[model samples]
Target: MGTEFLNIKDSVDAKNLIQEYFNKYYEPEGEEIPIEDSNGRVVFEDIYAKIDFPPFDRALKDGFAIKSEDSFGASEENPKVLKVIDALEAGSYSKKTVENGLAVEISTGSPLPEGADSVLMFEYSLKNGDEVELYTSVTPTQDVGKKGSDVKEGNLLIKKGTVLSASKIGVLAAQGFTTVKVYKKPNISIISTGNELTELGEELKPSKIYDVNSYMIKNAAESIGASGTIKGIVKDDYNQLKSKILECLEEYDILICSGGTSAGVGDVLKHVLDEIGEVKLHGIAVQPGKPTILGVIGEKLVIGLPGNPVSSLVIFNVFVAPAIRSLLGLKESSLKKVEGKLTKRIHSAIGREQYQLVKYDDGKVEPIFKDSGAIFSLARADGYVNVSKNTELVEEGEIVEVNLFN
Candidate 1:
């Protein structure tokens, strides 16, 4: 087993380095999925409108559809009276055409009657028997949605690599798409190491802790549309850990193991991966999670995260999460963030980058101080502020951006 920590990279440098590898070697595969099941997935191809939005000229409000010239010179005192030939509601089409002194009553979203050039609101028209009296004049296309006004046929509605959200799904549905082509989600296998770790629902022995990192990382991957599995726990034995990882690498695109990553005597995850595959990086210059390992065996990527629960989750968020997103063909620029004022001062070392867990309240944030092993440490945190490696102190009342967990 290799005990030396060589080629330790800066946090940001490590992410870019890993991302370049994925971009060069990994090509995202696509699958057709029902539009209802596409939310949170990435669109594999550009989606163009099959038909013009609205499909036809439609009424924007409940009104009388008429030729604009017919309502010209009309006033409340001396109104222009037109015979109502037909009435149409939403989803209903009118066969009757507005010609000469004839008009059609139309509801919002109803296709405009043939030959009608404009609509006069009901407030500006009085209905008596079959006649509608227009009290005000209207211009062409006034209160009327023209055909292809919203979106034109063959126009790009969604670009390739766009994340499928509820609104994006609605756009696809509006175009009569029942299914869409989307990038396949990556399969990630998680293994928690350390003999001191106990499975949930098992008896808690002295000096033993419940497994938390595995579940946390699994859910995090799931949130980003990756399929994740917990492969149980492995004691600090090299052979057991190596075999499990080797087996998982055959079936999974990414393997993540929490614990046994730090350079302690018992830390064997890095050594095992190094022996079987290649360890690209064994450590990062980041606080609380400096002992992260990035490696590759064949085409599969393996990550060894810190044993501490908080550190594991934080490192996963900063590095592993983005990598998973990249596997799904998502861009890192899509990460959402918001700026807030820090309620208190935050101090960090000058060399290593730091991510301070914080609680956000009404645009103000305060650091969450908890031990790494505390179960509620992350639960109480709403987000984190990434303090760069070059800076030392973020003074109180300073504005900083937070990347929310959600």
Candidate 2:
């Protein structure tokens, strides 16, 4: 056997380890779906606009669209005078055109009359007998939102692989897109294995506890723009777990297993992966989620997350979610993050990079626990503070960027 590196490197190494496996198996599969239900789904192709967003020159503020030169150098002392030829309200297209020395009374978002070059705010003008007087100087293109200014015709509005959100939906609507082609939600099967596990939403019986990691990670999958289903629980029996995982492997683009990823006895996930395909990675240099497994099952991406709820969520959020995006169709912008300050001291074991849950209040982040069962840690956290591998402790008042879960 070739010599092996005993020490796990860092988070980058951990990410790169799984990324290589994801690159091969998570390539986009063909699918078509509707735009309404496509929220959170990845775009399969570039979205082109057939027309501009506004589609016309519209007034931004409640003002009168007038020729810019008409109000040139108008002031309180010497006000410019022009006729108010027509009034336009929001949602109404202007039919009357502004003649020389004329102004068109326009409301917010109302289309500008032809020959109008600028808008005079309502506060800056006074109307008297079919004429308006401007009390303030106005520059060219002052208040007119020009046609095709927001987005032009034939412009690329959204690129392929962008996870659709409310803003994206609005953009699509502006482009007159009724339906769009998107990558179908990659059906994911999550199998939790361990004799110590009980079904979620069930009362615990004897030594078995609730399958906390299953739902925690499954919910994380949905939160970060992916669809996943719990394939239920299985005891630490090799054949039983293998059969169930095989069934899940056939239909799902991604397979996630919890509880049996470690090297301990009855660690069935490693064996099931070894039986069907190669185990690409065994361990990572990360606290709580060190026992992360990345591999391929047929042409699908498979991840065996550590059974701890926090561990499962950490691995799934930082690693698995990105893989789902990269393999399917999405960009890094979909993931949300914000920088924060550490309010308290935090210590970590050497060699393993740690993602510590932190609550931010008053410009400070309070440290959360590394224990796997601290679901409250995730719930209350503003985001996570990264623990560098070289550092053993993070001091208070240290500025650290946090990647928010929400």
Q: Please tell me which predicted candidate would have the highest TM-score against the true structure.
A: 1
Once superposed on the true structure, which residue ranges of model 2 sit more than 4 Å away at CA? 1-11, 29-45, 52-151, 159-168, 181-184, 328-344, 373-383
- TM-score, each model? 0.90, 0.75
Q: Write the per-residue lDDT of candidate 2 for residues 20-122, one digit (tens) a residue.
A: 7777655666466666767777788888889986788888899888888888789988999998878887888777888778888889998888888888898
lDDT by residue for model 1 over 1-406, one digit each (tens)?
3386777899979888777766765788999999999888898989899999979888998999999999999999999999999998889989887898999999999999889999999999999999999999999999988889989999999999998889989989999999999999888899999989999999999999999999999999998889999999999999999999999988888899999988788889888887899888888998778899888888878888999988998888898888779778877787878889999998989999998999888999898867666669787898889999988999989999999888
Clashing pairs in 2: 161-330
Report per-prediction Cα RMSD to one decimal.
2.5, 5.1
Candidate 1 residue spans exceeding 4 A from truth: 340-347, 369-371, 388-399
User: Candidate 1 — what's its lDDT?
Assistant: 0.89
CA lDDT, every model vs. true structure = 0.89, 0.79
Q: Cα deviation in Å at residue 382, candidate 2?
A: 4.7
Worst 10 residues of 2 by lDDT: 1-10
Residue 45 alpha-carbon offset, candidate 2, angstroms: 4.2
